[model samples]
Target chain A: MFRERLAQDAARIQKQFDLVLGALSDVDVTQAMSYATQGGKRLRGFLVLESARMHQVDIDRAIWPATGIEALHAYSLVHDDLPCMDDDDLRRGRPTVHMKWDEGTAVLAGDALHTLAFELCTRPEVGTADIRADLALTLAQASGAQGMVLGQALDIAAETAASPLTLSEITRLQAGKTGALIEWSAGAGARLAQADPAPLRQYAQALGLAFQIADDILDVEGDAEKAGKRLQKDARAGKATFVSLLGLDAAKARASELVDEACAALTGYGASAETLKDAARFVISRDS
Target chain B: MFRERLAQDAARIQKQFDLVLGALSDVDVTQAMSYATQGGKRLRGFLVLESARMHQVDIDRAIWPATGIEALHAYSLVHDDLPCMDDDDLRRGRPTVHMKWDEGTAVLAGDALHTLAFELCTRPEVGTADIRADLALTLAQASGAQGMVLGQALDIAAETAASPLTLSEITRLQAGKTGALIEWSAGAGARLAQADPAPLRQYAQALGLAFQIADDILDVEGDAEKAGKRLQKDARAGKATFVSLLGLDAAKARASELVDEACAALTGYGASAETLKDAARFVISRDS
Candidate 1:
């Protein structure tokens, strides 16, 4: 049942994504953009479309913003793969952009992708000027220095330290680095859905935390091939993880609890909430 | 006299710029924040404030966007100074950030600055959500792949080639690389001023071209000490320049013509246009 739903969602969004990716055709740029975007689970885009559907928001109106979220996600990965940051040579079983090309191209590719994301969201045809502005502001808040950048900064600082990080420290780091984007993804969908924002914010916060915990669990239990990058990279880097702090079983339990909270936040929306519920489940159950 | 007016404009905007830069600092982000933005000519900020003043707009209302433009300018310089781009070792007679820190930190610093620029502009106090959104869209258009990025792309393409680019090609390159930001700086200030955009855009286009020609002339004739970069780097890189394609005297004549055209755009505004007139002269006549 879950597989069917996931496949349906992917088919609906994948064509548009491919088209958008096609627009970036400089060989080096396309290569780097593909490396950053191609292998992802497409979870964020799913949330965008799913949440919009749950509220009966027009899917056509939502596609551009959804793509914008994914593009921003792709750009973040390109920079994260750089030797100065995670320094990982591989992603999704292929060489990272920096490894395949050079750091310079990787930098430019990420910069281009970042700008492209905004341009995509702000297209006059996407929605009202106000909606475009709202989307841009939300995305910028989540992706900018105050949000993802700060998280990455903390992640880097933690990497070089000898001492283990406290639980709160780890939460704070992930909240910015991983959680912020997830929150933005769901929030963007909700905004497009024109749902009441009070409940939407609640749903996003729970969903984001749940997603991060599931990722932590994957880092511990997933196979290297299936995970698409090196397993145990977080541990090797001496970065903190929920599994390290909570133990594997407890981490799994925590993820389950967060997912439950995420689902409960949608109680007011009833049947319309099915896709988001499935998306929450997918975050925990994925191999990668 | 022009220097005195420029100095006054610089002094007025510098205080606001400093305040915006200070607000960016927190305990964790201060080091990178300072490293990315501590010193520069602040030319873009001046344009923002000066343009706003020309229309009798409130300077306070103009400061945020002005600072945002300056931040964008600083971020571009940081990236341009990297090893893969202009490969400069010095910026403003000081060691470039990449030299002062490691390459990775330099990369992150640039990214942070870029994100910070948008964050600053979109702050609630800057303007109405609509105005902020407009500013964000304008800056993104000016700075992103279609604008500065395309120029940089052409620049990288030109770097390794033996062929001399035509004057039109060179103009397109500058239009994207240097001209976009200058144009946006004026446009942004005009937006703050609530000036009629049709005329402002025309003025900005001429000013942007004039600024590039001045830069090209400076590369040929300015002293290395004042330029704070290698005077012959453009020629060595096989990069097209106004001086290279138009010859020294022709480039000088063309630059003057552009400045005159730029100044002429402000004629209808009468005495309110003095600073802009001085700015046009300063662009071509500056030693650095």
Candidate 2:
């Protein structure tokens, strides 16, 4: 049920993204931006909309933040795929922005998308002034130096470190790299509704870690074809990952535990949160 | 007097920026971000503060947006200096982010700083939620595809075009690439005070063009040491710049006309806008 809902939400967000880019001139950067935003699982958007549904927040207002988060995610991917970064050539089974167009287009497209996220967050229809302000502020925090970017920096440094990262260090890195944005996506509804975000925050925290572990597990075991991009590259690079530190079985077990914690954190929402709980469980089972 | 005031404001903004980055633990990205942001003229920051002062907006509140614009400008410069972009090796007489910290660090640092600009925009202490929302939304419009990014993409596309850019094409590109952010900075004061931004907007439209023209003039004739970056490269590349298209004399006359128009836009503010008018005049005379 949750899987289908997530797919549906992803499709809806795709339309939202189209609207955002519809009026843009047919330039390389705009085309690259539109292409970069397409075909993602949009798990973050799903979290935002689902969390909003749980809080009885209107879908109209929720859509902007949902689309915004996904755009931010897409920007991250586009930049990560640059030759100067992870240097990946493919994303979502197609050539990345840098590979398809050029590095300059990719960089500028990612940057435009980055600013677009905040612009969407500040849309007058998103919510009240306070909510808009809060959303923009938190989105910045989630994606900025102390969050995803910091994590990327640490991940890069770890590769060249004299010693391999410890289990805890990997955990810390993943939390920033993957957890921050997920947490922000999950908390969107509570922020929009002006409700207490503690429960949703807890759920997202656990879900984020579980999602990273699942990614590591996939890199170790999943087929690259199904993943739509490179896999097993972490181990090949000799970098410490969740699987490296915990071993396969222990990593799998830890992910399961986190999924359980994620679900339990949503108990306050009762049956309304079943989809989120299912989503948490789905994190470990999905092939991609 | 205006020059000294701009310099003082630049110093104050530099201190504020330091406060933003000082607490982060040592990391490649953090260091790269700091390096990228250092030693700029802080012209945009000066615009924000001076504009805000024109409307009696508190400096305390104005400083956030002022600092935010500088950070955004710094991020643009960092990415602009990427090997796949401008391929520059020095900025403000210091090593470029990619040169000093590697491409990956430069990319991530620029990304983090980009997000930091929005984070600072939504700062609670900056203004009411309405004001913050307005700033964030307008900033996105100014810096995104329809604004600075579009300008950058156009500039890149121009490099390999079969023909050099026409005078009108160059004007349009400059409006986006350089004009958008400057206009936004100039309007910051009006936005903060919720006053009429029309006059300031008109002023900025003229001032921004004059500023770009001055830059082109400097590229043709200024000392590289004072400029702190490479110059005359545009002519070497055979790119059609303002100076190239209009001829040196015509470009100078056009710039003087723009300064006059910029000053004229300040008539609504009377004596309070004398500094801004002086700023307009200074654009054509500065060595760097």
Candidate 3:
């Protein structure tokens, strides 16, 4: 049931992307923007819709932040795959934006997608103006220098440092890189409803950590074809990851524990939170 | 006197940059962000501050959007100067971000600054929540795929086209590339006050075109030391510019005429708009 809902939400958000990007001129950059935003897992968007459903926020209103987070995520990936960054040629089973169009298009497309995230959050249908402002402000905070970019910068610096990062250092990096957006997505429902987000925040904190651990484990064990991109790059780079730091068995054990804590964080929501609990479980178990 | 006010506003906005970026952790990305944002004309920011003053918006409130536009402009320049783009090595008489650091740092810094622009627009002191939301929304429109990015994409396409861009084509490109943000900056005060933005919008339209024409003239004739960048690259590349499309004398005359139109648009504000008229005149007269 949770998987079905996740798939449904992903399709809906895909339509949202069409609506927004279609309104732009038919320039190559816009076309590149469309291409880059396609084929994400859409887990973040799912978290948004499920949380909004938990709060009784209308789907029509929920879709804005749902699509916004996806766009933001897409923008990050496009730039991350740039020749100057991760230098990856493949993303989501296709050529990266730079490989397909060129770096200038890739950069501009990513930049446009970033702005579109704010645009979606500020839409009139999203909520009251206060809510819209809060959403955009928090989104910026989660994605900017102090958040995802900070994490990425640290990662790059780590690549050239004299020594590998410690476990704690890796944890701090992941918190900024991947954890911030996950927490924000989990809490968006409460933000939309103007409700206290402590429980969702707690839930997301565990979920995000578990998610990263799973990613580390997948890097070691998962199939690249199924994952739809290059795998084992972390090990190849000799970078420390959850699996490397804790050993594969210990990393798996830790991820399972984090999932339990995540499920516990949703106890206040009662049975209706079952889908989110399933999501936490799936985070650790998914082949991809 | 107008130049003095412009410089004063620039200094004030620079301080705002320090206050905001200083609060972030001293990461390399933040350092690169500070580097990218430093040393610009700050004309867009001045337009915001001056128009806000005309609308009785307090400096405390007005400074948010003022800094926001500059940050946006800075991000555009940083990305535009990338090795894959314009490949500029010097900006504002100093090494470009990529030259100072690496391409990864430069890309992350530019992305962070882009987000910072929205963050500034959504600040609590900016005004009522409605106004803040409107500012962010309009800013995304002006700077995103349909605006500045569109202009940039078109410019890149022109570089490889079989024929040089015609006069009408270059004009359309400039509208998105440079004119959109200028119009947004000028209209921001009216947006803050919930007043009609038509007059300021009119003023900005003429002023923005004149500003680009002046830039073309500078590219052809200005001293590199004063302009602080390369000159005649357009002619060397055989790219058609305002000066190349129109004779140099005709281009100068057209810029002067547009300055008159820009100044005329402020007649609704009467004597209180003298500084803005001076700014329009300075657009064509200054070397940079």
- Steric clash pairs (candidate 2): none
Q: What is the lDDT of residue A216 in candidate 3?
A: 95
What is the C-alpha lDDT profile of model 3 across A166-213, one tens digit per residue?
999999999989999999899999999999888998999899999999
CA lDDT for candidate 1: 0.75
The numbered model that scores best in DockQ is 3
lDDT of 1 by residue, B212-242 (tens): 8888888877898987777877877767788
Q: How many backbone clashes does candidate 2 have?
A: 0
Q: Candidate 1 — which residues are off by over 4 angstroms? A: A1-14, A17-27, A193-195, B1-30, B193-195
List pairs with backbone clashes in candidate 1. Answer: none
Query: What TM-score would you report for chain A in candidate 3?
Result: 0.99
Per-residue lDDT over A13-130 for candidate 1, one digit per residue giving the tens place of the 0 to 100 score: 6677677767653546555665576756777777777777766778788788777788888788888888777788988788888888887778887887787777777777567767
Candidates in order have lDDT scores of 0.75, 0.92, 0.93
Cα lDDT, model 1, residue A172: 84
CAPRI docking class of candidate 2 = high
